[model samples]
Target: MVNYALGNNVITQIGLLVHDIEKTSRAYADFFGVDKPQWFWTDEAEKAKTEHRGKPTEARAKLAFFNMGSLQLELIEPDRNPSTWRESLDSNGEGFHHIAFVIEGMKEKISLLEAGGMPLLQKGEYTGGRYAYMDTFKDLKLLIELLEKDR
Candidate 1:
């Protein structure tokens, strides 16, 4: 498995970049025999809280999620440019993007990782949570997304 962590827990989500979220998500769910996927968009105003490279970016995407036992598989369809998803898709095509771990003390963890040379590539908010994506692809072969939920 891709080795990364949040606090003490292992990475728990498998994220992917996709050209078509609904199609890819349904295909993945069907292939994995999982339940229907949950959907979300990143375009809504007053979204959780977000920053891209230490600045606010209007990056957006359509996302679909599937729960398979202990991991959530995510498919992202890029809806805006100047975002990580777009970059990944543009550079690498459709495939694995990042793996995530939801944990406490998110900002602190991000700081530690950033201080250690892993730059913060992208960050954004969801309904009740926030997330930061660290550029760990060189070391881990995949981006690392750190999630912090306030519920």
Candidate 2:
């Protein structure tokens, strides 16, 4: 499993990027035989960008959040815009985007990672907790989040 945490907990989440939102999410839902994930549109996440990246910009995203047992999965379908998701889709075809780890002390963790050479791609607070992104591999991405309970 992809490790997004630093000696934290077991792998708890997976993020997938797709060119077609409905098709991919439908496949996963059918495969898992689970209810559809809570959907979030670009407008809802507009404030998320500002909180993390500090800008009044929005990208069209069709996001679905689902659960497999205790593990959470996020499927992303990018809309036409200049966003990290869009950038990733442009560079690489639809596939695994990032592995997210639930952590504590986001700023401290981010500082250490940044000092160690990992760059912070974006961060935002939504739904309850704060999340940060970093490039752990040349191709794949890493996302770190402090859960609501952690904070």
Which model scores highest in lDDT?
A: 1
Off by over 4 Å in 2: 1-7, 42-46, 51-56, 138-151
The Cα local distance difference test for each model comes to 0.79, 0.67
**Which pairs of residues collide in candidate 1?**
none
| 71-108 per-residue lDDT for model 2 (tens digits) | 88888887775566777888888887777777777777
TM-score for candidate 1, please give it: 0.87
Residue pairs in candidate 2 whose N, alpha carbon or C atoms collide under 3 angstroms: 52-123
Best by TM-score: 1
Instruction: Tell me the RMSD of model 2 versus the true structure.
Output: 4.1
